[model samples]
Target: MRKPTSEKNQSEIAYEVLRQKLLNREFAPGARIRYGPLGDEIGMSATPVREAIGRLASEGLIELVPQLGAVVKRPTLRDTTELYEMREAIEPYAAAKASQLISARQLKSLQSTIDTMKKLHDAMTAGKKQGQDIAVRFDKSDLKFHQTIMNAVNNQRMLTVIGDFHLLTEIIGAARHSYSIEVLEMTIADHTAIFEGLTSRDPEMTRKAMTVHIQNSRELTLSRLQDECPQ
Candidate 1:
C-alpha cells in the first residue's frame, strides 16, 4: 500500500512538472513527448512518466497516439474559437455570480493583482522594462484574478471546466502570440473594467464587463493566430 502511494505521489509530481513545461511552451505544440527520455530528464521511471502522460491526455493537454506516443496538443483556430465561445458563455455568468458572493478578502486579493499588473504596464510604457520581461508575470496575475472569482462560487465542476479552458488558452496563446505592449495594455484595461464592476457589486455590470473582455480576447487571439498561420 505504501509503495503504491509512493508511486502515485511520484506520478503526481511528474504530472505537475510536465504540465508546467507544457504551459511554458518548453514542449512546443505538436511536439512529441517521448516517455523514456522524458522520464530520464525528470529523474523518474517509465511507469510513473506514462501515468503522468495519461493524466495530461485526460486533461486535453496532450494527445496519446498508438504508434507515436504522446504529443502536446496543438489547438487549431477552430479550437481557439470554440474555446473562447465556451469562456464567453461561462465566465460572464461566473463574474455575475461572483459579484453577488465574493468576499471582501477575495476582492482585496484581486485588487492586489490588478495593482501589480498596473505597475507592470506602467513600467513597460515608460521603457523601464521590456513587455516580454513582465509578460509572464502579468499572465500569472491574470490567471489568479480569474481563478479567484471562479473559486468563490464553491462549485468544483465549474472551476475544473473553466480552469481547463484557462490552461488551454494560455498554452495555445503562448505558442502563438508575442504578448506585445499594446496587447498588455488592452488586457489591463479590460481587467480594470471587470474589477470596477466587481467592486461595484453590480451583477449586471460585472457580467457585461466580463463579456466584453472575453470578446476582445477572442478577437485578439484569433487575429494573432491567423496572422502567424496564414494559409
Candidate 2:
C-alpha cells in the first residue's frame, strides 16, 4: 500500500486507506466494513479502525446500519448529480482564475504531473501499477496540481469548499468499479488538455477545458455507477 499521506495518527492512515478502498470500489457500495477486517487488511488494529470509520460515517462515505454495522454509503443519482454540479460550478472558475496567475514553476509541476500519470498508466498495462498502493499518490498529485491553481485564485473560501468537493470525488473515484484501462487513458488525455490550456494561460480556453472535463467526468461516473449496480 502507498504510505498514507498524513503521518500523525494511525487513525489518519486508516481513514485514507478506507477512503481509497471506497473510492476504488475495492469494497462495493453498501458492502459491510467489519472493523476487525478493515484494520487488519490495512495492517492496523481495531482502535484505528473505529476512529477511521467513525470519521467516514460522519462524512457520508459510510453509514451506520442498525443490524449490519457500517457499510459503504450508496450514493444516489441525486447525490452524484449534485456533486458533479458542484464541481461544474467551481472547478472551471478555479481553473480560469488559476490560469491567469499560474507560474512557470507551477506549470512545470503540471507537466511532471502528466509524466507521473503516464508512468502509472504504463504500470497498469504491465500489471506493475500496485493498484491502490500507488494510485493514491497519483491521486494526491492530481489534487495538488489543481490545488496549486486554486491557491493562486486568491479565494480562500472557494479553495476550502472545493477541497470538500475533491474529497467527495475522491470517494466516488475510489469506489467506482467500472474504471478500467481505456477509461483511465481517456482521463489522462483530458488532464493533458487541461494542462495545455493551463500552460497557454488562456483563461477562456482554461474555462472551456475545465467545463468539458468535469462534464465528461460526470458522464463517465454515472456510466460506472450503472455498471456496478444496474437498475
TM-score for every candidate vs. truth? Answer: 0.90, 0.74
Poorly placed runs, candidate 1 (over 4 Å): 1-5, 65-67, 229-231
Clashing pairs in 2: 22-175, 23-173, 23-174, 23-175, 24-174, 24-175, 25-174, 25-175
The digit string of per-residue lDDT tens for model 2 on 98-178 reads 888988888888888778878877878888756665557667766776777787787989987887677677766666533
Residues 77-113 of candidate 1 have per-residue lDDT tens digits of 8888989999999999999999888999999999898
In candidate 2, residue 171 scores what lDDT? 67
**Where is the poorest 10-residue window by lDDT in model 1?**
130-139
Off by over 4 Å in 2: 1-28, 34-54, 125-141
Q: How well does candidate 1 match the true structure in TM-score terms?
A: 0.90
Best by TM-score: 1
- In model 2, what lDDT does residue 175 have? 61
Q: After superposition, how far is residue 76 of candidate 2 from its true place, in Å?
A: 2.3
Predictions in order: lDDT: 0.85, 0.78
Name the lDDT of candidate 1.
0.85
